[model samples]
Target: MQRLSENPNTLLALYRISQAASSANTPRDAYIVIIEELQRLYDPHAAAICLINPNTSLLEIDYALGYPPNLPELAIHPGKGISGRAAFNGEPILCNDVETDPRYVKLIEGVRSKIAAPMIAGGQIIGALNVDRDHVDGFTEDDLDNLVHIANEASRVLQSVWRKRQLVMQSSQLNALIEVGQSIVSKFEIQSLWQTVTEAAHQLTGAGLCTLQLYESKEKKVSLQTVFPENLEFLDMVGDIAVTESLAGSAIRTKRQVEFSNITTPDYRDLHDVPHDSEVTSCLSTPMIYEGKVIGIINVFTRERHRFANSERRLLQAFASLAAVAAQNAELYSRVFNSEERLRKSERLTTLGLLSAEIAHEIRNPLTVIKLLFSSLDLQYPESDPRNKDKQVIREKIDHLEEIVSKVLSFGKAPEGIFTHWDIDDLIADTCLLVRHKMGQLKIDLRHHASSRKARVNGNKGQLQQVLLNLIINATDAMPKGGILTITTKVEQIERRSVVALYIEDTGSGIPENLVARIFDSFLTGKAEGTGLGLSIVKRILRSHHGDISVTDTSEHGTTMRIELPFVR
Candidate 1:
């Protein structure tokens, strides 16, 4: 103790080791610094730095010098050997006669003297530093005190490094969890979702393998869905596990996280569906619960025996929750998509029927005139005259055509509805109110210009409202980046007839020149997801009420849809 306190060189060595250990980036770096300093100061025959494995509770040499090649792999139990005993007892040991000391376990060929000191921090012994000399009684009491001081400094620095590493790991895990949550929520494909869940869990937890399994309530079984690394043959080897058996089943039944330190041990080996693969040594399982019911299970496996930390276990539980939400979203999306498809089919059939009736109505007017005019051209000729026979055939053909038109009109007869006078301005205002929320969400600005006088028109209120609503929604869709929508209504006179005109315009990219001419044609669209039937249906509804719609003006600045109805007298 006098030599260690008086010698300036000894003080300098201690300061240098402390600096080196404190500045190290990792525990391994600190270990190397401590072992190198011990070798330089004492010139011992053998020196080693060992740490206790939290999972195994064994003192394993992390850094060594001058020892046999296989000595680093030696596992020393606490209280079993000189170094292990020092660590277990939390004290320093100086033995001059190794052959007489029953606690000494020979690691090197001819070591007779040994000194060991425990490295302690936070009131816990972490490991020990050991040194050996070839001759008995070679080390002094002063040497034992110096080694203990060096061990203490190393322990303090190493603990600091471990805390910093843990903080960094926590930050990284948080970022990974956020990314996984977003990815799982946006995607709905079952296979793709399963792949993402397994890969993310494996990478985030630093596990060797990850497996995802879903619970089937009717079957009372949990079946493996996906595995990370994709090439692992566990899919073929593993089968559906009953809800009553296995670690995964236990988690589902308990609705909590379950872990095993050494899954290869006899206690877990006999469990059904246990992964018996040699590479898998430890396992952590978390149940996927949604709405208080377990939907699935997530399991992460480690290649070496490890006790899962609290952080890792919590991260797995979070991942399981995200997986459950994703599965439920996928199911809902499927049902909605199927329902939308069926609705579209029904709408198409209804439109076809309406168009058939409209065509028949147009043909009946001209057919009636032709039939009446032909009968008036009666000629007084004999039955053998060819002209008379030709007239007879023409009359018969016209009658047959009239019968066909009547059948078509009857098949798609429009129902009679009450028609009342409505001010165009009030109608447009009500329609805009319905879509005000949508417009606000899209950042659109609506500007309505009512007429100076009431432009009243007689029409079915419901059908007219449908026309205005369709036009408003279409205008909004055109201005995807949120532009201005202007609606104006006024009374006008065209060819000496009074009419009410309503113009709906949008400040959007103009319709393509190729599409403008056929804008109201059925099944013609400018949008990727458009059905191409909205404008066509709107035009038909307007025509049925003695009104019409047309694209009055179109340019790069925008498009204007004009609707004209006869003014009520």
Candidate 2:
């Protein structure tokens, strides 16, 4: 051993070990200097500084002078070997011959004496200072005492380094949570939200694979919603698993989290045969929940064996909760937005319908005067005269104009809702054929479906035709991007009276509930340039004919409009 020369040098060496913690620029550098000082004070054939691996809680030799060739492969749990026992109980051990002691685990091959002293800080044993010699009974009690003293000297430096590492880990976790929260809240689409959540999870945990498995309660099935960095073979095999079969599914079914520390082990990897599954060591799943109900599962995977910290699991739980809430809120907002838009549209159309009625009234007055003038003149002509034919054409034209004006003014009253024997199915077929060309250009598939015998109704053919045409046009406008339009005819009992019903179904944006109530009100229309009189007229004609119209159903998928006309007795 280096002659300490005097008690002053001995004191100086201990001081250096204590001061090295704050004096060195880095934790690694300080630890290196501390180990060197321990060896310099007590010369031994072999010496090493061991530290506890926090992840596994095992003693690992950080730096060793003489150990077995595969020393790095050795992991000593607390209280197992002489060094481990010293670390576990915070005591010092001086073995005169390690070969004679059962507690002394043989490491290096030779005649041996060993000494191990626990490194303690804040009343906790963190590791140990260990040394071995080639000669038997080489280390004395005084040497063991000196080793204990060295451990104490280095304790301050180790404590400082550990605390600093913990702080860094905490800062990273907090920042990750904040960024994820902002990303999820800003997303409105369900697919986009899933992507954000899964990608964030992969980045935060540094996992090899991350995924979202959504549970469809209606189907009682779990399916993968999102898989980040998508070429994982194990995930492909476990793509769709039943709740009773897989870890992620179990988490969803039970509304809890599940974890597997090493999935490649015989017990788990063999239970469910993951196809071509390789390289997965850890798996963790947290249920995505909102309002106390499980929606899906957030799964993370790692290639190296890993133990999930409680704080990390809690953070994932927080992320899943936020994702669920955000998705639910976006859906609710979409519905409310559609409803409000329809209500505003209805109000505007009603206002325009009132103005239209006034214009029709003024036009009717001028037409009556013209009719009287033609009658007062009493112009007569020969039957063969071409002028007589022209005069007759004028009369017919005026009468048609008169009919239109009357219909306009009596829009709600239905002044001309005359009943007649009308083949309803035939009428729909004709109208559909008329618009087939237009629908083709819009990429809409138009189909006419009829069941049972042809339905004949006691309704004005012209008026009913107008109503059907208006409904068809409105439905087409709803699907500007093109979709399926189905017209079906059937006879069914409505309140015990058999009525002929015409149903118009369109794969278009559904009507908002608020607007459905006022849909038939004059001047209310969905189209930007529509006068909104068509459905109002259709409602008037049907009501006058002892029939009615109603919306069968409407949603994001599409809308169905029903026209009911009482059958002729």
Clash statistics: count for each candidate: 0, 2
Q: What's the TM-score of each model vs. the native?
A: 0.68, 0.58
**Mind giving the per-residue lDDT tens digits that candidate 2 earns over 101-141?**
99987666773888999988898888998887888888877
Runs with alpha carbons beyond 4 Å of true place in candidate 1: 1-7, 170-186, 217-219, 231-239, 266-272, 290-293, 325-340, 356-532, 535-569
Best by TM-score: 1
Among all candidates shown, the one with the greatest lDDT: 1
For each candidate, what is the lDDT? Answer: 0.83, 0.76
Residues 1-569 of candidate 1: C-alpha lDDT, one tens digit per residue: 56677866557668877786458778788777777788878889888888888889999888888876785469889998899999999989999999999999977688989999999989899999999989999798988988888888888888888887888788888898999888887666777888888888887888888888888888898888888867457776666877777568778778999887778878876566666764899899889899999888888889988998888888788888888988877766555445445545644775787688889999999999999888887655788889888877888999999999999988776554688988878888876665554566578998889998888999888778767767877787778899999989888999999999889899988888998889989878887877788788778878888889999888989999999999986
